[model samples]
Target: MKNILTLSLVTLSLTACVNRDNQYDYIETPQPNQVADLQDDDTDGVINARDLCVATPDESEINNEGCGIIITSSNERHLHILFSNDSADIQPIFSSQIRQMVEFLELYPETSIEIQGYASKVGNEEYNLALSKRRAEAVDRRIESMGIAADRVTVVGYGETHLEYDGDDEMSHARNRKVTASVVGYQGDIKKEWTIFSRLPK
Candidate 1:
């Protein structure tokens, strides 16, 4: 009878140990909440993408698929430097404007510009084309001379094309003969006002 009782007690202890091990084997570890971790709270069709400007105001103008807006208030990014007849030289009066542009490019190292040169309808198409190219190159050289990298500037000659004013007047021809500098590949939010170019003192 004593041996039987001792054996029964041993069997009960072993069964308890087995039950404890089984319980531990079936236990589950905590997992991360994937739904809670998801971004894009505003749901403006833009994800948590860092390349674009996010969380823009509802009333603000957005373009380029919510990246930024076209700044039209100031011509800081787009400048028109008028030229004399049959001349590719940048006048001294426009030096202040070019300097301001140079300063802006210096501030934003990643920004690049396109210098588009134009000519009046007074000359032949081929001659005007070459003249416009020279004008573009002149502006490009000026920008490069101001310590800006040559690679950042692109020269384009659009002779007698996209005329700002179309008329048989001197003012129209003068307006057509110009070089426009436009900033490209700017990856920043469009502000209300850009840096204005200060005119040089007379």
Candidate 2:
């Protein structure tokens, strides 16, 4: 009985010591979830943060973080004018469209348009080259006559090189002979603006 009591006392003391020394601790968390901050570049209510020019810029514009840039937009660089089998005359029907574009450019004095001309694959390479150049120059003169500044218009020719359409048929050849009125540095209607807290570049 004395041995039994000694064993019980020893077990109780061991149990008490184990329970006293038991340990526990809490773990810390990392950074929390957050949203992107928006800022106003243009005074327009639409934040520039959501602007297409900021998120995805066309060839004409580049997004340097929050600060935006306007470069030459590729879409406005060419206006094709079809020739009469081998002529460089600016089509009468296309005149009105050219006039409207010139007027828009006039409104934005800082903007400019580049005119490119192409010819069909009918003539010899050298002839086609000269013809295309003439076509582009013709369009440039016509636009200049409309009172647009000479400096704002650039004329160039790309012989039957980059055809809009390709085939052995006349229809395809017709497509090849054309001029382009490419407007550069002109921003469309400012439908929205973005206000973004841009991080400074390292």
Candidate 3:
């Protein structure tokens, strides 16, 4: 009788797992649970689960670590300043041009510049080298005096080397004797991500 009762209980348990029509028919299947979505809410190319900084601004420059990075965008400024022969001194007339460089640095405070000074081949190579550096410094001083920080300026001189015009004409020599610099500015509108509590209706 005990074995007969145990067998009846096992049959009932097995019948519960199968369809009502247990005559070699298909078994019943439970409804599947829905899966959650993992998204890049900040849109910095990193998923929210792995993103440490969901408040990334602009999302322009970002690392795999999911944080904001400084972006450097290249811009070039050409100043028309013709220097005198055998002179490293910048004239007062070119103040406006130098001011423009200062403004460029002002627009992008995080950026620093290497002012390249060039010299004509008219003088001794050694003297011209020093003169070339001085020319770079000449612009550096002017820029610094115009409210730019001195630490942001790097002066480099190339004496009779990499001349804009290799010819010996006055215009060619004047073109060679000058300073050049490139600018890299931070770009795009900085937009902060909406936090969980800080988010509001659109």
Candidate 4:
């Protein structure tokens, strides 16, 4: 009788273990953010393979992948400001763009920017290169004055290398006298740029 009792207990323990295993299998699993569902075609969870924004930025609506594409609108695209013939003084019109970029950078923990300068084909290669470098430095100084860290900017002057126009005329030269600002590094919660996040059923 004792042997039978022991056997019965063992059987019950085995059954309990199996039940626990089954329960674990049914437990709800955590899902990634912003993935879309193709089976249901309308469900949203994490940004998945079919997600349209393949280059989906990793950030909130405001913090895109260092690209600053989230806070900026496609219709009103931000362009680099052009400098005067030999100066880096930013025109008043570029103030709004500067403000926008500054605001965006402030949200990240660490951020860096690159300023590149180009010159027209009018001057000799060496002269144009030197001029471009000065223009780039001028713009970098202006941005640094606005509270961004000086060490974070990689100032470089290509000197007419990235010219937008080919000729030495005013129109072509005008295109070459420009400074471009590019964000290089930033740290923060910047993930899931494209996806329906609200429709999840929990």
Candidate closest to the true structure, highest TM-score: 3
Ranking by TM-score: 3, 1, 2, 4
Of 2 and 3, the candidate ahead on TM-score is 3
> Between 2 and 3, whose lDDT is larger?
3
lDDT of 4 by residue, 36-95 (tens): 443422223333334444443444342221222333222122338887777667799988
Query: In model 1, which regions exceed 4 Å deviation?
Result: 1-76, 184-202
lDDT of 1 by residue, 51-92 (tens): 266676544555545554645332346668999999999899
| Candidate 4 global lDDT | 0.65
Query: Compared with the true structure, what per-residue lDDT tens digits does model 2 show for residues 39-125?
Result: 755533335656544443322223444334443332343354577778887768888777777777776788877888888888798
Q: Which ten residues in a row have the lowest lDDT in candidate 3?
A: 188-197
After the best TM-score superposition of candidate 4, give how far the Cα of residue 2 lies from its true spot, in angstroms.
26
Off by over 4 Å in 3: 1-75, 191-202
For model 3, which pairs clash?
none
Q: Give the C-alpha lDDT of model 3.
A: 0.77
TM-scores for candidates 1 onward, in order: 0.55, 0.53, 0.57, 0.51
Ranking by lDDT: 3, 1, 2, 4
User: lDDT scores for all predictions?
Assistant: 0.77, 0.70, 0.77, 0.65
lDDT of 1 at 111: 82
What's the residue-level lDDT of 114 in candidate 1?
88
